[model samples]
Target: MAGTYHKDESNTVNRYKHQATYDVDTIHAIVNSTPVLHVSFVPDTSVPVPVVLPMIGQIGHYPSDSESHCYLHGYVSSRLMNLAASPPGIPLCVAATKVDGFVLTLTPNTHNYNYRSAILHGHGTVVSSDEEKLWAMQLVTNSVVPERYENSRVPPDNAEMQSTQILKMRIESASGKVREGVPEDERKDMKRDDVLDSVWTGVIPVYEKLGEPVGGPYNRVKEVPEHVRRFVDGENARRWTYAVEASRKPAPVKRVKKQNQVE
Candidate 1:
């Protein structure tokens, strides 16, 4: 049965949906469960853009029937595979982390944190089907931003579509772990006045903020995009809104060194 993943009003998980740390089978199960994969790529040369969107589509499967080799789908593009086949090992590492909560403890020793994270290490192969490519693009966008595709323009053309290459990696090894609760020392420090009176003693909440929006090239007619406007008015929206506004301001110039300094 597919487990339901839900977030509370605070965006924190009240219950764990899955735990597949020790069992390889379980890990594979979770990997195959999701259509979207968050990938991190590292390139050999420093370029204007290091991350290249490879072929899209479901190009591979992990833990093959023999349980020995994972099969990657897609045309064998030398450029794409060469990066994956590099001597040092994988050129990229991809993973995801979810912040659980701030643990408040009576004593410093009892202080702790809670989080759930998954790290996937492996090489990726490009996937080549046109039908799959479209699906993959939809999956990737929706994964990061829900309903994003519904509001955005479709890919302009086939060449434009083909420009993006998708890569699939077999999950060779992976792990997921979590920690939760108050510090163990709470019992010993329960009676300490200093511990009780310190204003900063409890867990200080953390939140994501959206800030005001800056007008764009089309601002002459259209109001700020709803996406941008929503953040400005939403609770805990200041961070993003403020960042957008800051980006519009001119950047500070760096000072140059004098020609004759004691050398």
Candidate 2:
């Protein structure tokens, strides 16, 4: 057991405790699986509302370390990026969610969705060093479409780099919650023969299916790029399989053995 991440008061999961996981690997996977992350921050205390924005980002770690940091890129003059770049940086919360299936039950009260979600609390600090900024920018670009950075162009030109700013967020705490398997009905509902006969109860598997690529009119490439083609096919297949299995079977609950007191 690599030590578990500390659960701070704010991140402690209060509902469905069994669905909560503080494991770093589980939390990272959930964050990476979602395409876009929603970032929320209060620009100023005087302002009544917080601002939320959809952003593209990725999680990565240093070669010698297990801890991870999130990298995000935006226009140099954007409001959010400017605020994050200010001294001490701005406090932000990042959230990502992926819905696997819609659990339909005989009773309205028992209905719920099978999904995976993660929340990360961090301070958004700008990446200043040129080398690190380039690396982080490349990471974010590739995240949108794998291998896209290399396939399209080499290192970005000076103007492009100058216009873009990258933020390296230091994660303070994180939590992940996942729900899977078929609908769970109450004993009373299951025992009622009439209810069972009249209502259809099961999971309606849901997945984000990628469509075929349609290139632009000016596109010179004769065929769709191999990397792009593979990504679409691969993602669709993975989601389809996960949805099918989760619809029928229960997720396996893992039990960990306790370490010996004297070990």
Which candidate achieves the best TM-score against the true structure? 2
Give the top-scoring candidate (lDDT): 2
lDDT of 1: 0.46
Predicted candidate 1 versus true structure: per-residue lDDT over 36-137, tens digit per residue: 335556554566345533221222223223332222223435655677554343444445444444555665565644444554555665545666556666
Q: How does model 2 score by TM-score?
A: 0.89
Per-model CA lDDT versus the true structure: 0.46, 0.81
* lDDT value, residue 202 of candidate 1: 37
Task: Write down the worst ten-residue block by lDDT for model 2.
Answer: 254-263
lDDT of 2 by residue, 1-263 (tens): 24456898978887677788888888787777778888888867578688787887788874444667888655434666678776678788989898989999998898988888999998888877778878887777888778998898778889977777877787889898888987888889889999999999888999989999999989999899899999999988999999888788774353443486221
- Kindly provide the TM-score of model 1 when superposed on the true structure, using C-alpha atoms: 0.49
TM-score of each: 0.49, 0.89
Residue 131 alpha-carbon offset, candidate 2, angstroms: 1.1
